[model samples]
Target: MNNQFKDWKSNLDRFFGHDFWGDFEGMMKPSIPYINMYQYDNEVLCYVSIPGMNHPKDIEVFVDHATLTLKGKIEINHRGGHQIKAEIADGTFERTIDLPFPVRSDKIDATYKNGLLIVQLHRYISDHTRQNPVQIRHLEDE
Candidate 1:
């Protein structure tokens, strides 16, 4: 009986552990910006569409080898003109993504062009995980 109970517990843990549901939710949620991620020979590139954000000071990027986080706020200045349609999203938003592979936290770059934010992360060559936290860097930090 003891062995059978242990086996059942292990099976349950295997089926419902870690972040399986959270990962599914992240992919299904529409509130987060859609990301296009691709892996290259030595780096990974992620692109996100964020229109109307004209300044670098409003964005923050962080990576922890296996995960990437983006948080920022979009502020739109509206003139006194009344009676207009507004469809753009404003206010603070955050999105977390699970990276496909371990990335070197020390060698991450981000750039904003037109209405897209491009992030490049170099693949970690060694098995060592970074001891420090990934810095939250804005576009101007480069």
Candidate 2:
């Protein structure tokens, strides 16, 4: 009976252990600096939440045809005391967002105020009907 009880306790520990839950918790959480985006007829706007940053210039913003990337670091001043609880995220982070349409790279603007980064982008209009003619070659010409 003692051996059976020990086996049951071990099985319970294996099922509800700290190691298993720790990994699961890490996997469930998303990355830091959560962002919200809005789309307009000719523009796209994004609002990014990143607090505790020293300066606005610390963040880097990159814009491609249809993607926007943000890179930055968040640092917390501990004041030389041992940390008891840490809910705010620190360290370097990069997040890429997909835009609804291709944006004009030269017409992008960004501003940081009150722990929020606002980005404004203009949509790029391309001529879809314009096509480049491809030259076809015969196999014997190789």
Candidate 3:
């Protein structure tokens, strides 16, 4: 009975094609780099993991008011061997992260070292947060 089950499963897999379930699972998920973020009273720090890149220039970092964007490609050298298994992803990818507070564009720093990209951002205070009084007009007075 166990052998019959195995044969039946093998036949089903063969009919569907090689790695059909794997391909379907990959399609159902979005690939993105892993990241860690830290927020301080007046600053924000972000750490992104990106391996197999030759140079820091391979990645592009963008900062908006409260969002950070990372775009890059990860390349893996096969080194002339038959690949029996592959789990690591290697390709062009873009990921955006939302920050807790708006950051100052001028006060931003980024460094790539040991396959990790570190970003330091200073918080910015917007004018809208300041105390502003609204004038109330009396129509009867007019």
Candidate 4:
């Protein structure tokens, strides 16, 4: 593969696969929410789409260094006295990721609006600390 055409490889990929069901609802339905990532000088922003959710507190966000997991629930209305029709994944949702640098977990922040959850994690500065041996004086026995 040439260096110039490497980026174009993904654009030419024409998927010719089959699913359990027909193409009517298999390839056209959007069930799970989509997520986007953005990097900044001292923080990283994650945008997750979860439309029709009423409260942001229902969602969960977990982070440890390079890994981040997001779990959330969404409620829906159905016929026959308001049932459930979940398209935004009302159960456990997870997304594990690797960050370029360490993040400051204590300073991480999150906000949700318009059914989109936006998470911001501050970056931590890596400071190489060294360890050295120290001499101690022994106490005399009683």
Query: After superposition on all CA atoms, what RMSD does each candidate show versus the true structure?
Result: 17.4, 10.6, 7.2, 12.9
Q: Candidates ranked by TM-score, best first?
A: 2, 3, 1, 4
Once superposed on the true structure, which residue ranges of model 1 sit more than 4 Å away at CA?
A: 1-29, 80-87, 127-142
Give one digit per residue, the lDDT tens place, for model 3 in 76-109: 8778889999777778899888999989999999
- What's the number of clashes in each of the models? 0, 0, 0, 0
The residue ranges of model 4 lying beyond 4 angstroms of the native Cα positions read 1-31, 80-92, 129-142
lDDT of 1 by residue, 36-111 (tens): 9998977899998777687876788989978989998766777688847856656678989988888888998899
- Please give, for residues 1-142, the per-residue lDDT of candidate 2 as tens digits: 9999677766766988745545766797678778899999899999998998878989999998999999998777667878899788778899898999989988988998989999999989778833578989998989
User: How does residue 3 of candidate 1 score in lDDT?
Assistant: 100
**Residue 12, model 1, lDDT:** 65
* Tens-digit lDDT string for candidate 4 (1-142): 6965554443344333433234544577554557788999878988888776778877778899877777666555445675455334454455566776778888888898887888888888655532456867677732
Superposed Cα deviation of residue 123, candidate 3 (Å):
1.2
Estimate every model's Cα lDDT from 0 to 1.
0.80, 0.86, 0.87, 0.69
- Report how far off residue 84 is in candidate 1 (Å): 6.4
The parts of candidate 2 lying over 4 Å away from their true place are 1-26, 129-142
**TM-score on alpha carbons, each prediction:** 0.60, 0.70, 0.69, 0.57
Higher-ranked by TM-score: 2 or 4: 2
Most lDDT-accurate candidate: 3
